[model samples]
Target: MTNDPLSPQSNDSQKRLMVALALSFAATAAYTFFFAPKPQPPGAEGADAGVVLAQGADAGTAEVAVPPPGNGGTAESTLTAEAPPPPLRKVDVARQEAKYTFSSEGAGLTFAELQGRKMREQQTLTIREGFDKLFGKPVPTAPQMNLAHPVPGQPLPLSISIEGNTPLPATTRYAVEEGTTPKGAGTLSFTGRQGPWEVTKSFLWPHEGFELVYTVTVRNTSAQPQSGELRVHYSRAIDPEFEHAPSFFGGVGNLSRSACWIDDKLHKLSPGDKPPEDTRGQVSFFGIDQQYFLSALYPLDGPMAGHCVLTATPTAREVAAGFPLNVGPGQTATFRFGGYLGPKDPDLLRTVPGVALRDAAGLSTAAAFHPKLEDTVDFGIWAVICKMLLAVMKFFHGLVGNWGVAIILLTVLVKLVLLPLTYRSMVSMEQVKKLQPRLEEIKKKFADDRERQNLETMKLYQEAKVNPLGGCLPMLIQMPVWIALFTSLRNSFDIYGEPFFGPVWTDLTYKDPTYILPLALGVSMIITQKMQPQMMDAQQAKMMTWVLPVIFTFTLLQYPAGLSLYIFTNNVLSIAQQYGLRKWLARKGGNPTGDGTAAVSAAGGKRK
Candidate 1:
């Protein structure tokens, strides 16, 4: 409530700091409000960065610039005779948006309904096409894909195959041979070849913690068996342009290209395996933001399939394939395999035999390092300590339903938990503040010799029992928790669109359009910094006093509003903690002035 600590500046340089901070805020507000370009309106003509030419009043075709009758130009040719208006091509924007589901069902598979959810930018698997087909020509270009959400008890559309390179003879009739050994793993036998040609396949969803294994047996109908290539191709029609690369089904980074998953590698699969053909089989996985997906995509094969893990951007490297199999007539060659279709759940993936590749989960893919070793000498130690601290915070979060409240409670709990340590630091800071006049005197007395002044400063620190680093240690220790929590909140899907006190902070991953939270955060930051006793040179402190808050304000402007709220709450709470500590120290001879602003107790005194 005191304005002295809340003022732009205090005993030290005040006017310069206030002016600089005001200018900075003004410039930032101007840039953010007036100077920055606004987002283009949806469906506006030429709004696709000038890609779209024009818009019509009706839903009819709008004339776009095209080349002359002979020339291949995208520009209107004034020299060419005016051609009759091109036939109107009605473009149904709404229909196109509703038309396609981005995933296709595998051949012979019956998909009742397919629902699609985005996990991250790269890996999105939707059930696109599902239908029955006589596989004589592999159903030509394949059936149209479907995107309707699956409903239980509904019969799945069947993908049937009647024609193939090796098909049943015209005289042959097929009889069903069902197997009961494995659940949903069935076999149907056809009378052909020499005896029964057994077709082994399953349509039902695999049982939990179970794998599907199929064994196909073909016998020689004629006395003399024929030998031919049993070309078995696993054909699944995916959105060719879905991710650009079929191998890397998940794209790279936040703005990744389309991806393809071939073998184990994720790549961009365009139309041509070589060149010229630009039709990419992969669709862009650039916008699907799911934490489980982002963390699971890397080290894909693991025990954590179906679990909520972050998906990683798959690399462009090629994946290795297992050795091919040889199937002989009369002697059935069995090929056993399995796959995962949904999210990566470790428990589910680990239980399935021969499919342990799905358990890959957690956040170890991001490289851990600092730009400068000297600047982050003890970061590793700090990270571990911070993780432990966050664990404590998480423990509290588990008790509370609201993350915002959890953060506030966490801050309070931390402040209360570290009261003694902070008190000690403040006591030292108070000692330094009290001796400031003496220190300045010493500086004046030894003005000509810098080394002597430093010696005297060290002596003061030794005499007052103040560790220069004491005030900073607690703050430094909390940094890892801050960073980790920021990361968690930003990436956690739970906080998406999660509201906290009106629209001021609804989404933790995006900024508030109104910017009320950032402004509040900035104000609180300024106040908190003011309450702390100044330790640096007057000019430096004045510069930093305002500069830091401005920097933080700008940084928070575009960050998750939840983070800004946390910081604002932390600052406000710190003020109360400082005030209380100052009062307590004053009573104990730590501060003689009783007021936190004035020099008092040495218990949490400044570092020499």
Candidate 2:
């Protein structure tokens, strides 16, 4: 009313309401014309299965046209705002050891099946086959290992996603191009676009290795600028029924895990464990670590600041490497990545791209490649010892060409290294035997004074120039070597699937299917214990001799065959060494070798 009355202090309320209605109507009309759902054309109707560009994004930049894939690549239909699917297609690229299948839906790895002898799985032996193998019958090898077995649904390995102001889902499809690369390598390029960005994933798979060079390029297609984090995702589906979590006290667990090397350290998450909270740092590599085998991706240009998100469940393991980017109109940001999908072999993993790899993946001279992929093989707390033992075993293996023989040779090497210590310990034990009579008298003398008994025992030990605890030193020294060997068997791929004289001792990394090795180990352990001087009270001696052997056997029964084999071999050698030591002692006017209890009986007679 005031506006109608001009310059007065009032306006017309009805006029204002009409103006609001008109503005609302115009917005509704615009939305209907641009975004309202349209009817399906012909037979273009079905389940909304295939990936599509997110709604409300610019339709002009929705589809990146692709030429007909002439060089064995598939011709993919364009993804539209109204049209749902373009029919999923696939392409396969085979290297020497692994064959990778990429899906056009996500332009990512569907399955990475590893080939070769050692990579072959271990078959379940029947009772009849077990007996035949125990008697030295050869068994057929198991099937090849599939790095992407039980494939995860959607957002497959090496998929791309853009998160920020204009987000792009990983489900978006890409037009793929497949061709042969230089140096007999296989190549595959995936190109797609949504909203303001166009993305391309280029891969170079060498002819004969587990390495792959990958490059990701994202370009701003819209007139306006775009900014976000480019995420590269890797996922694997594991059936909990078949997979088990790793346990040091228990046997070797074969469950695959997710790992990321952020900053200076490596972070791993096994199935059903909590994910790392702080993962922002300079990332070196990340992927699914399946113990003996690995499928990982690392920045080809070296470590760079990035955010890595890790996830694990009873059924799946996932890792996403996110790199921040800001692209001006028409500008492109490209990121290079190096990938490894093969055995966690230190020789191969530790080696960067060399001259042989220069022409393999069209890599930038292969000199800029420095990915610390070897860390995937976690050596636990005994890394130093593990490395030393593994080095010696490798040297011996090179000489003998047999892993079992190498382990035996390693045992001998360790024994020889500690020869001086063992000799000193043996002499000390013999001297303690001479003082046993005096020790019993002292125990009876100070029967009620426990503190006085201890002081007198120490004084007697010092006077005799002997150490009563000397017998335990050799065993203590060898404990580290044993643990390192166990760690190698659990992780080091060099001995992961190797055979030990064939048959029941098929795989050293795996537990012995037959209980023969562990049982033999227990027998050898008992004989060795009986040969050593019993330094403890009657009850403790019984526990050490009987209870310890039974428990040790039961424990080794579930451990890797390599460990039990090492102990059994060491015990046999120890028995031989002790026999020789006793003969030497007899010659020196000490305990004789004939009566196993000669020294003990003589001491008892003297004490009486």
Clashes of each: 101, 4
Cα RMSD of predicted structure 1 = 32.1
Q: Which ten residues in a row have the lowest lDDT in candidate 2?
A: 66-75
Q: Write the residue-wise lDDT of candidate 1 on 1-608 in tens digits.
A: 34586555553457778888999999999999988988867644342244343344442443332222223322322211222222322111112112211111211222211123322222222212111121122222313323222222221111112223344322222233333333332223222221223333332223232222222334332222334332221122234333343122122112222222322223432233332112222211111112222111111122111111112233211111112223343345433223333323333433333221212111132321111101111124345554454466557668876667766787777667777787777876766676677677778899999999999888766655567777776677566656756665543444444456642343444455466778888888788778877776788777767998897688666556667777778788888888888788767766433543342234224432
Q: What is the C-alpha lDDT of each candidate?
A: 0.41, 0.78
**Poorly placed runs, candidate 1 (over 4 Å):** 1-291, 294-398, 490-499, 591-608
Give me the displacement of residue 580 in model 1, in angstroms. Answer: 1.4
Give Cα distance to truth, residue 572, candidate 1, Å. 1.4
> For each candidate, what TM-score against the reference?
0.48, 0.80
Model 2 alpha-carbon drift over 4 Å, by segment: 1-86, 121-132, 135-141, 275-278, 361-367, 591-608
Model 1: ten consecutive residues of lowest lDDT = 368-377
